[model samples]
Target: MHDMAQAGLTKYVAEFVAAATPQDLPDDVIALGKKSILDGIGLALSGSVAQSGDLVRRHLDELGLMPGAATVIGAGRKVAPRFAAFANGVGIHADDYDDTQLAVASDRVYGLLTHPTAPALPAALAVGELVGASGREVMLAYHLGVEVECKIAEAIAPRHYQTGFHATATCGTFAAASAAASLLRFDAKTTARALSIAGSQSAGLRENFGTMTKPFHAGRASESGVAAAQFAAHGWTATDKILEAPRGFFQAAGGGYDENAIRGRLGAPWTFADPGISIKPHPSGSLTHPGMTEMARLIRENDIKSADVKRVRVGTNSNMPNALIHHNPHDELQAKFSMEFCMAILLLDGKAGLGEFTDATTQRADVKAMIDKVDFVIDEKAEKAGYHKMTTIIDVTLNDGRVIHGEADFGKGSPANPMSYEEVADKFRDNAAHARLGRSAADEVVALVRDLERQPSLERLMSLVAKAG
Candidate 1:
């Protein structure tokens, strides 16, 4: 074990985690915690029956792991905390419909933060349930986990992502470990040790983005976190200075480090409160959201038909195109990352939703024809404006010589254009229905999450999440 003086970045985070209490959280932060948790659970419910979720569930069954206290979301089963975390984590991100952290997008040079809740919430819920933690305890741990993960993402961002690392799986491991440690009520030393172990286990690559492996990254991160914390609780040793050492995580995984970004403010004003969370309005990449919303709006308001448009041009930041890597997607998974596919669907159907991205829909001749006419270009001005505030410009040229243009500075569901609680609940209901979970159980989950802090335990909430089918 390293001395506290030599503990470096790990010590700072561990100390904060050890010292923080539910009383330290502001009302709004607590509220945001509940909101983020609800969104993650909703996504997990929808993803439970997805291809990736089914794959992992089958793998776990093959392993024949012993049952534990934690429930696997929408699977109607119990498993060990680590397995449960892995399954639920995969489920949350399986559809690529979870929340995104755009707080660091303004740096232009740095990549965006990972989806903050995907790994953290699963770790919190699994551990919280295993330990019989209260709703407030789970919320507190969840908030701390996001805080640690996002701060690290800010510290070593664009480099971390540009280097082919998946931030959700890499940074997310630490987030999950931090929350699990909190749920386990670890001391500062143990928490720091767990984080150190987490750094060693962190692994995920962006090259797998368009496949089932993408969601698997989240699952492994969640699993690693529980394992790290559990191992630390049993007195496993690790380098407490793992985050700041010359050969540590940032040095090896990130292009470079911004010490100040990690060390600064330490929660003077919460990241969630400032940049906040962007609940998705669409199921595609967050960067493509502004353009998708605007395109749909333009088509609907102008009464444009598929045959009316000659071509569509979309302009966004340079980095925006990187996430939308699938230029000619042939599958549903690939279509989520294909700006052309998303744009084609919007122009042809006047909307893009969960049902719009599918193998059958993507292969349709009309969709293919529309995809051929959609063009994506990096706007120099928009790229110069930076990614912190994502912007999009759309210009549609009609065969009739009519041109229509629209611009969006922020996407719907952003903090600037927030979704109401009712809207979020509706999304949850729809996702639950898609998974064949009964409406009554879905409604109960929504109600329980809204009043999460008041719940005596997470038992009722977890029970409601079990798949009806």
Candidate 2:
């Protein structure tokens, strides 16, 4: 640990990844980590049924890419570990429903830090299965990957996201590499080089939001992690000071970064316990959740109908307009990022689940009319709440000219208002059923994950969840 005191950011991170062991996992971490992993699997299974996810699966089938021993979730087959990671990553994020890293700083916007589980968990599962790792080892690898990814995200300047980069894909490349290297027991030097290799591989654009390409960023990042670790294991060369170097990742990608966010902060507080993470209650963008929550609340408490609500106004800071770009969505993919669509659906159905995001739902006359009645604006009041909070103010005006005010700073599954474990289980069952997994299989998957750290291996767990009957 003392060695990290004098090491550069990259070297410190590499050493942290190299030395992680499941034996020292705290009780709290074990509990949250298992739930996070379980949640990732559920989202992946549910997302696999999506058109984007099916396309990725079909592409891999077409290539018949190198046959290896790695399970592709919902695909009922094994492929190369890298390819499997890619497929699973796409599946996990296909609906934009994966768990998100919480924002730590005021300038850091919610939902932009990264989707902590998407890239990291898929890499851990693919690599762990390839190497026949124990269940604890795989879970530990996943936690380590998330830790490094979050720290890097914190260290980077907020402008990185504001300037059109998708942090989940860019930061996630490093996360996947960290997980793969940790699972493989790469030495410190190899770990450092793997991270360095990942820096070059890091890529994702904000411009790709509202399309299948956005999820593809998560897939590519996961696959790139596998490729980088494999490359580093074979003595691939790269600068050891990838993070702190003048022209290295921090400066090249983000212009500048904060060293304090990295130094001695790798696992000292553990990312999950401090800034914490949010499990999404909705499949849409995190930015849209608060508004949806407020709208749903106003409707439910007031017993108002969609037709009775003559006008609605949703206001947030300027950052939201850039992230939620789909003003009018034509399909489920775009609906995930459309504030207008999200609120309209919640107003109409009281909830927006996987079943409500179809293209048909988006084009319904009532839905379209509701969408037209809502306005998204940048408000000074929301800006006053600061960027760290996803502060959303909702103003609903009824046809009778009665005005109702509602606001939500934290969405349903936020740390301030967490979901119970049973709720998470219900979510898992719903998603698993959507993917066509039998109820018995879904129950077993939950049981397996509940005691994941004690399981002998990933064999039974992955078998139940990854492959169809």
Candidate 3:
């Protein structure tokens, strides 16, 4: 095996570095960039009250160290850029409602890791504001960073995901670093060094989902990425090819690396195509959602009562075991990732929304009993597909021996079946409604996001987004 470290990230990094300015991208990418920016802002604003958001904010406040570099999303306080990124990123992901990417899946990760809570956009926005970079410049850096991160993640394939690493944290560092480097305009060598440094810090355990630590992963990644870029801009030195080198990111994190997946498709085939990223219609694990929706529909359509459910069997891909498999959840956050809890809520409540996953609901005796009756079976075929084309086969066996089977492909908001703009907006409003910001603030956000590109200054965009909604 050759030394992957010395292999060449220079050319790739240089190409990305050269195209860091917003003026260098196509019109479509620019449009997508604006969309992502708006989405990230919306998600962060909504997260202000989420358990994760409040937890992070209190932690930062407790630190009592203010650097006044940038604004923390809903707090109206300025702090160091690194901490700002950390806090805001946490806010973005607080509700488990941020975008996701189906790392090993062939389908576009699409909405899984889009503008909402996107590390690249918010990271760029904060860094750009601190350094007086223009909106166009910040957008450019964010787009380029997102493209690079997606490509690297796409290349890692079955390895990156199958090894149990969250693609967002592992690949997001590069995205964050690229955005920071672009805003700072670091040279090729320094940018490459930054990528290496950030690569070393990429980490997020899949097991941490449903706890406060999940958002912590996002915060840490954003901070680490920014730190890497700053270090590189200052002429710091490090390994050049941290991605492909032996025992490098790909080899170590992803099971096996595919050089072609990373190299040949940089700008030719834009990943931003069909960039209508999925906005969350509901705040729950994306995988668990399809089943949740279907179960709710069945209960509503057939009027199946909780008392009618004698047994519930959920068949899904192997990944479900890691996502939502709780028999009894103590709180809503856990219910968010708990397939059993979500399904039970679906059966009992006829829907799994914010309220269904609340602490009161998850701990309800009826819900707990229903969750216990829920069990799962893994389909090898879906597992082989790497859970990308995951489908849920739900079997509800009633007390009357009435067997109801429901199967759905590409649940709501999937690329195959995307949510309408109104739907996305509705979701945004739902999350942001009870915040300090009122309906008018939410409406202004909707308008600003829709007309993002036409604005003369990012100040307007930031002002509207930063409104303590």
Candidate 4:
């Protein structure tokens, strides 16, 4: 094991990235990496139609520069690798629909981790395509990036998240840089410089959660990461100890560094294989998923009508309220973070898919009426129990004096109750169809992703994404 204490956190991560190989990744880890890639592609495809995604795409087009550098995921256009990463990263996270890193939930102070794939995959794909990297190389880069990002998140979270820093943007920048550096085949010294530069550029605020800027954070992180790696490969200089110095990342952004948490465990258990990543069943805030699942079940099992319910009560972890900040959401973006909106939509529509969280749907009289009737109550016990083991209890009161109760310990897409491969494929197809991608094209993407490690180059995959229907 590398001596992280002596090496410093940034150097340790860079060395790990430099040493990572396809052989170092276990079979299950490789499979998980592929799954995460597929999930991210699906989300990006669906998000391509989002107003925010469209805006970024148009903005990039207006520049009229950097042709043939990399392919945009769903637009059949080419831009610089950094621009491609930025645009695709936005699309992947536009609806908050990407996978979440579950290991960060272990932190006592905060329950959220960076959405690992949003930035890492974009950076990997953009750089991979730019350099004609093979599928095995791309997958290796992605795995290395996730390892570095999740470890850093584990070492500094709760404090990082509690301080209103968006981990997906802050930690994700390093994740992107690591993936880019790996694909570019940078040595440890160059990779460390990239990480150090990334540390200085890392930034995003939770205050932007409900706006388009939230997804933009992921985009900016991806862009900054590609730039950092490109600069570092050309002899850019930065402090070698950017993550552990007195005024470094953990000290300035995080309350303090937890050296013990980061060191001596580079890949001891493989974070992706242990706590794993949660592919979201709903496109909204992940913390609200369990409640959405139970509410949908209760409404279905009891044949509850929207008008029959006088009021609805939901109980979740105390910290969830702060995360789901929009109580009475007026827009689609806000609706995704609003527990009331999510619950109302699930009960009103029977399912909460990408189509449900929209401005038109959120502003509907029936949906608003239901949203008004729903109330969220923080379960002190659940909060104390911690987010990783959190549960949801939902109670519904009918106008006729009857009550319905339901509880869910884990969301459908969580590791405790994981979505089957078939389900994940179904989700991908649904997302693609929503984006108007042809059925044949969507199936080809799925097949290619499943057998990704065998491809000689990402050219075919990028071509398929570019040719989206």
Candidate 5:
């Protein structure tokens, strides 16, 4: 049974690798790819100046690899595909504020901070340009990469996640490899071998949370994936069945998986179509965003001053601790994982933006006082739906005895309640604005991404990212 499963994974990996390309990809897929690219670049540029981002750039510089194929969005330097992928991946995750895949159940089931921006974008861009793949081809590879990453997360999630593995980092290597392989038009055999290499190389530790190393996991995974595919292209081999064999990815890392989850919904039932994916409104943890938005809305609708609120109690699920790791985060990155900090800031300021996580914000005595008053209540029911349905029920007990209860069922940017195109564009522009790209540059990136399939080449897209900050 294990042998057959390995053979099956190898076969499918090969097929996906061989047939995957942007040339014939659907328009929606292309649009999604471009959107992801724009978002990644925006995030990367902003993160480039972040303390962690700068550190990664320094490390990459020390590696002394040949400068080549692709650009690392913020750094404005070109390097080998692997190093580029690594550095770019770190940029995307630096803020701890990228995309996520919510689990169906359990805090033990780690909800993946799944698709960060730079990893897939750089890998696809490098491979596509190197192979002379059109702009459309790059988009296809990206969409395919995201799809692969999300599916793998779903397959091993809750179980693998419970075991304390970062699904994005652990599984992302294969996802990136698959995307790069698709762009390179590798044979199925090579694709399978790439996946095999990725599986073995996959790693991420939960202990790394709230540290710079967490982002390193993302960058390294992407670099490894790109390297894996490139190595396979040269006839390097890996174990045939990386996902399904008794000793494969699923069986080894995945504590006890639903075997059906691995291959059940290959194409017909897609992760992209259901629960869809969240486009971040703020760069903080996705689990906390909804509550923050709702609290901010409540405070605004009632014109509640920050001083009026005596105490704020936020009710969520058991898994929230993962999202809100710090009751008092030492820095912006730590604050991003703190639920109390998120809620307090939302009510105090009524807006959660990029600057919300800064040291100045964290040091604000008012914000600290509010954060101190905030307490978390875990509801088991909310835990079952995974992090997706994090019901943030906030009861503000005022000094004047006005008890207001505000509950948010769906997080902002969730498919149940999504951020609009204008909002996403606005977010992209805001981040890009810091880089001084101007309104025209931001608009051009959005417009080009919106109609990516029609573009002759991704040169314009790449050019925008290569902008010096």
Candidate 6:
């Protein structure tokens, strides 16, 4: 056999996405997929109404587009499927509260995996709606997208993230394309072209993490995916071997990649099922969840008042300090990427939920004091444990000479400690309520996704989430 690494990798991946069917998905995969789709929908609703939400809910003219057949979640209007994908993707990632992929590679930083749902689901929803496809079609398309994206993420050079590329936007474009291509019913050759085209469009930067531009990356990736598929359907030209070309996607973008990560790995275990996905319980960078959980635990168990605490020390692997860039954040967006702010908010509020991450909360004197009290550091032990694990150590000092210690190796909502479907539904309810969605409609959306395979079309589901409920 020819070397799989240096030849036909693009066609190989494209064939998998183009041919995978619902029969390949087991009961549990569908169950977890529905949960993730539900989470993405809920987050998109809340994201549609944030203070910076106007960035998405704008006139089509401002977006340089006209109306089409696809729904923009919560926007009460239809737009081109690509544009719908763009807007809804922005909403899903706006709060950084969507589902995150988990990589098995030791060099990959914990919790920094691409926010898979943010890009994949929007593409599936947009194109699935565009084609009047069944719910199973959409579900299968989304799973295929996530699987391709996660496998690609696993194969790429670790320095891709270390050198500041946001994997969500970079790898996610491929996810979006795969999802869209699946829904569009493109053949393997056409899908290969789409994947190649998506590689050219892939782009995002870590420097944009704390601003609206961050979510915009996910939006653009989703949009680019939709556009790439459409372009290929129209016979757009591109190298079909983009992923394996001598100077192609992996080489140009990430320097190199591990071919073994892709060979026989696409659906061998279903990345969504094997390594699994994470539904963020908090609306911040997932890297902070472990510490946030520990902080919440400390306060809950000890009934420790913030005023009683003299200082807080949070330690993690060295990579975290670099990625959680906002050392002393002053806004909600910045606070999401700030370890200090997340810990402070959890300490002050006893839980870092939606209402607690407001800019007003960040600027509060007490919150500011708590921020100063947090000593965010790089732990030698955590560093030694390897970057693949998100290990965090916490030490709380009370003014009364009491010290509390907590360590978290895995986040509460991770595969190791998964939230049940019921729990995910609860989060969906809170997000829908945050977006002003009616309880009755929100309940129906949950039921619809829960029974995804039985549904004939996305008409009801899109109608519920796409309109201003």
Estimate every model's Cα lDDT from 0 to 1.
0.85, 0.86, 0.71, 0.85, 0.73, 0.88
Candidate 4 per-residue lDDT, tens place, 1-469, comes to: 2244455667778888898888999998887777788888888888788888779878987888768678888887888999999999999998889998886445553337778899899999999999999999999988877878887888883777876899999999998999999999899999999999999999999998778898999988988999999999889899998888877888889868667777776777677887788888888888888888788778878999887889998888877887789999988878888999988888788888888878899889999899889988897666766666658889899999998988887787887788776688888998898888999988998999999999999998878778466
lDDT of 2 by residue, 429-455 (tens): 888988999999999998899988778
Count of clashing pairs, candidate 3 = 14
Q: Which regions of candidate 1 are displaced past 4 Å?
A: 1-7, 103-111, 303-310, 380-384, 398-401
Q: What total of clashing residue pairs does each candidate reach?
A: 4, 0, 14, 0, 4, 0
Q: What is candidate 3's TM-score against the reference?
A: 0.83
TM-score of each: 0.93, 0.92, 0.83, 0.92, 0.90, 0.94
Q: Tens digits of per-residue lDDT for model 3 on 1-469?
A: 4454537854586566655555567887565455456556767877776766777778788989756767777776777788888888887877777765434345433234323335676678778778877656777777767777777877774645555687777778888888898888777777888889999999987787557777777777788889898888778788877887766788788656667766756655556654334445567878776776678778878889898889998887776676565656787777776778878777777655554557888767888788789887796645565555567888899999999988865567655666655666776676666345677877887786666545554565565555474
On residues 1-469, what C-alpha lDDT tens digit does candidate 5 reach at each position?
A: 4444335754664576577644555544444445556677777777777787778878877887777777777677777778778877887777766666545434433335476354566677667656767766777777667766766776664667665787778878877887788887877777888888888899998888778888888888888889999898888867877777778887788754555555645443445455466667787877787787788778878888878888888878776775577898767877778888888887777777887778789898888888888888786655655554667788889889998888777777776776666677788888877666668777888888777667777667767777645
By lDDT, highest first, what's the ranking?
6, 2, 4, 1, 5, 3
The TM-score between candidate 5 and the true structure equals 0.90
Q: Highest lDDT: give the candidate number.
A: 6
Q: lDDT at 368 for candidate 5? A: 84
- In candidate 5, residue 5 scores what lDDT? 36
Instruction: Indicate whether candidate 1 or candidate 5 has the larger lDDT.
Output: 1
The lDDT, on a scale of 0 to 1, for candidate 6 is 0.88
Instruction: Predict model 1's lDDT versus the native.
Output: 0.85
Cα error, candidate 4, residue 178 (Å)? 0.9
Off by over 4 Å in 3: 2-6, 20-36, 62-69, 104-117, 157-165, 251-256, 274-278, 296-313, 317-319, 347-351, 369-386, 395-405, 465-469
How big is the positional error of residue 99 in model 2, measured in Å on the Cα after superposition?
A: 1.8
Q: Which stretches of candidate 5 lie over 4 Å from their true place?
A: 1-7, 21-34, 104-110, 116-118, 379-388, 398-400
**Candidate 6 Cα errors over 4 Å, as ranges:** 1-6, 63-66
